[model samples]
Target: MKGLRKTITTAAIGVLAVNSLVMGGFVSGAEIVPGSLQVKEFRYLDKELDRISLEKTGEPDGTRDGHLSLLIDAGEGTEIKSIVLKTADRGGTDTGHGIWTTWKEPSDIGKYLLAVEHDGKTLNKTFKETLGSFKGVNQFDLYASDNNSMKDGEYYYLEITTSAGVIKSDVTPFADADTSYAPVLIREFSWTDLTQDKIGSAAFGEDGSTDGHFKLKLAFAQKTKVLSVILRPTDEDGKAVSAGIWRTNRAGVGWLLGLVQGNKIINTEFNKDVTAPVGNFRGSVTLDLYATNNGSIKNGQHYVIEVETQFGTVISQPVEFGNKESIHTDSTVFPFKTISLKLNAKEAAVDEKQVKLDVAPFSFEGRTMVPLRFVSEAFGAKVDWDKKASKVTIAKDGSKIELVINRKQAVVNGAAVQLDAPAITRNNVTLVPVRFVSESLQMKVFFDEGEIFITDAKEQ
Candidate 1:
């Protein structure tokens, strides 16, 4: 019974109700009325196995012992004459067909006449009573030895031929009993120079120069195929830029290109129909981001890469492309600086300059908590405090961080992010988690022997 329950639950998850009418059929002298029959729920019951795998493997070795549980809803005032369940291969050839009658004789009103056929052989059976006999809801538990036993890669669907019209359910594939599901994982992602030499090649055309190239590495936990790879620009706070501001190209209305692996280009036309099975893939993708128009990628913008696979879609962390020096006319680069603080110490160092803190840093709940105003000011950011609301806001460059006292949620530029620990107020000084605040402001935090170091430089 436990195995039967698990099979019912697993099959219920893959049920999709998409009912449509069969077109191009007209009666000679009668006006056609649309049928109101719908397949409410469909479940594949395998008495031998406890679970069914939705992954598409090759055809099964042989047929399995299985049945089907179908729940149908016939609309009011519309009577269903007969119900047909059929199985077909991937190429639309009928493998099995079954027909059940609802209205026949006085004794057949409650008893259903079921007949199934497979390979020119017919099996007839009489079902006692249908479940849920009230209010047009009917449940059918169908069983057939050879006609119902389906192989992997075969599709099954239900069609209700009512007095009005014919209503067909969406075709669903039979599950493979051998394959288990596993999601794809993004192993590594970064900007690289793998495709730098081939910038102006015939593959890229003449207008496809980019400031940098993105290297994406993926690992397939199971057998899967790549669908698409997209690169989208984001803000400093990692929110995607609006679609109106997306960078376009002369190649197409949107930025679309083939991926490069070593020296070869795969998926040349962005066609997903002709993809092979992937194990571990590493490739480089370049986007043309320079134009004199308004929708081009900005100078100091950040971008993220999204890879869609057969298992699922995975997104990478945001990485910056250009800096402030490229955006502004002034070519002056901001000097990278490091700030060091010690636990329970009133003194700190900012690039050899000593500063005094009113409240010393301490450990709260295994997290390093530091004075909010002192640390934010040291990093050349402006801090504003609201006494009545007990809220603190830190702003630097284009990033804005808002934190409320005693709250575990913080907002970065308009997006809400969870904090490792809530901000606390001690002796009228606000203390926050150093790592969360530093990372939110686009800085890196490191811990040594007894001290904490914060830096604005790229990690080596």
Candidate 2:
């Protein structure tokens, strides 16, 4: 049984209950570092290899043998140090009923318990050596009745530790033996000239109209191979206008999805029924088509999704395939922090040479990038700068900020700001006010004590 057991000793469990009662406990653990738990080791039980790949879909089959071994990283900062494996007693003689080896004990000699001490906490799971009562174990029942409810080949949970709390993901696995889907590439057909030359021949009454064209690129990860593709287009009402499956050329040129490879006109179901996501490009709209790749894609490969319309071809900005591991990272790097208010600078003043402001959380180059102005104004400071003289000033309730340009030197409320390009003015706008905006807003400005320090603080 692949399951979970909160490895806290009986005493530790009491402490958590007490803490919750006293603190009005609202705990979370998944927000620690990303990808904290890794699959350290896994093995297929050779004796029961057939059962490991059994298809329990549709109808239940008790003839399958289910047993496996997995070792995970279990140590400090890790939420679970062990897993409990519980199996039912099949042979009325009580031979098959026992615990699988856990982290606390080795499985080499038929010991039970998948995870154990040597870490901050432990979790336990069970595996069925042979199909028996059909009642398997799961994370919820790992400690109760010494069992869990789970089918063979199911993934249980991911545990992580955080300052505020711990988190877990209830994951499950599937077998490919039951059903398999062949991957297909989706591409829109249309024509385009990279040179931007005007085609004299017109297909419509509008300008830039040409004969049938196709967008060669398909929407899938770069690592995904185009085994086969189905091309379909629908009107605004989702009535299919054309549909065909094309085989891609080894070297991607135009698509070969119509009839024969550069030979015949492919048969199409123009009247087929379908639905598509709609997007507007100026006055015209296009249908958003989806295509499933024929194979599993690498987690982070960038791919291009292109569409061809009667007007012209519009390509989607490149996107990366989703990865289970990066979900938390993406949220953290793009979470909503503060709203940014872009304001035109008012004026320049004495000792008030720089200003700071807060910005809504934004991302650049996979990092959280904030606006300087929003960060500053949030601190109750009036920011102003001189584009010609390259001077910036911040006055909050008479607190002054004086800063120079292209140098790690400035005075904020009499304190110095060691920043490069102090309150830079660009396009008639100032960027990055004096670092003192951090202290002014009661924020913590952190860095290597080098050229510049990024700061964070709550708005007033």
Candidate 3:
């Protein structure tokens, strides 16, 4: 009454579309759409005025001029609390009033202001709908603490005026079959597609049959009551599995009598609808499972699917059918694998000191050679070249070595020595074999797996 402002508009869309919302700010875990009200359990109040269809009259533009009114009796300790505009049926989105609603509760003595949030700015626009006490959103916390709480068995009524505008659906109005009955729906929590989180292996068993189970990441938008999770096994081409093939249910026994949905590690059943103090819209729970489809599945059939529901499904694209391991992240796309190489302090020091060769090592005349200046300097050696003589000299620890390009011999410490591989230039790199000089300079070099490891054995 005080702050209530009416809205005038004309547009509406309709669908059983799937949607989800995240919960927050609740006494339990996360605040969900208030639901604990039983819509499906209405028993008609055994009277002519119990429950009635919402008469929706509209214009040519799908606009409608109608009103939804509810008469009820608040039992002992009960109150006419907050109201939620539902956007969908319990199954999925089918247009309901999904918006900011303002209303006043009527009493025999006087009418009192109760709730009003619908302005142009503050509408809960996620289009999420819930039907119950999802994440511990208390009933009392919804409305302002005032005349909102009604006395037990006292009757009160409220009304909403729908302007001539596009309209979809509203809450089904009902009179009291049971004056004490109340049930509310939390909003749509999530609509998950586990195609990417699909992971498992199918491989040849001792009997030459395939053995493995598929795993999926099942996350709900709300803590939902899971009714069914059906996986249909098919081939790479999505054809039915051939006969004579079977999969076991974990013990490699029982011929996998059935498909079970549960977190085996925690030994908790995932198929069962979760009650209070249990579910939330936080992280995920793994749904690991194996199915036989009444022993009709075969080894050739590897892929399976989660039957579609109000909450979507688990699915993926076809791949080369084989006995292999597969795992997906989210979205059921390709699995991105990550690798890490751990380098400790000592190894890190070597890495920091190792010269980054301008190019990879190459072989000439059966001897591996490296860039002279860079490789030599990496090991604390000084290298210089004489352009007039086409000669390269290396000096380290007072030992001097000299070599001429294309020559097969070298002078080390003023002593001439035979060279199996001569110094040469290829691709602008003056390459040389440091085997003889390095060993002589108290250094050890080893090559493996296409990499060179050098260790200085000299004492500083």
Candidate 1 lDDT (Cα, 0 to 1)? 0.47
Considering TM-score, where higher is better, how would the candidates rank from best to worst?
A: 1, 3, 2
Per-candidate Cα RMSD to the true structure, in Å, reads 23.3, 21.3, 30.9
lDDT of 2 by residue, 290-375 (tens): 22222222234333332221111222223333432311011112111212222232221111133343222222222222344555
After the best TM-score superposition of candidate 3, give how far the Cα of residue 291 lies from its true spot, in angstroms. 42
Write the residue-wise lDDT of candidate 3 on 1-460 in tens digits: 0000011110000000000011110112212123222111110011101001111101111111122222111211122233433322322333322232333233222322222211011122121121111111111111111121221222222122222111222223222222110000111111122222122222111322323345555543222223123343456654544333222212111233123346333222221211111122222455455432333433344554332111112233322223343332333221111111111111211322322344455665545565667556656789888989999898987978788999877787777765546788866668776444444454544332233334452110
Candidate 1, poorest ten consecutive residues by summed lDDT? 1-10
What TM-score, to 2 decimals, does candidate 3 have? 0.24
Q: Tell me how many clashing residue pairs each candidate has.
A: 0, 62, 30
> lDDT (0-100) at residue 210 of candidate 2?
22
Root-mean-square deviation of Cα positions for candidate 3 versus the true structure, in angstroms: 30.9
Which residue pairs clash within candidate 1? none
User: How high is the CA lDDT of each candidate model?
Assistant: 0.47, 0.28, 0.31
Off by over 4 Å in 1: 1-182, 193-202, 205-208, 236-239, 242-252, 268-299, 322-460
Most accurate candidate by lDDT: 1
lDDT of 1 by residue, 425-454 (tens): 888899997766676666645443356666
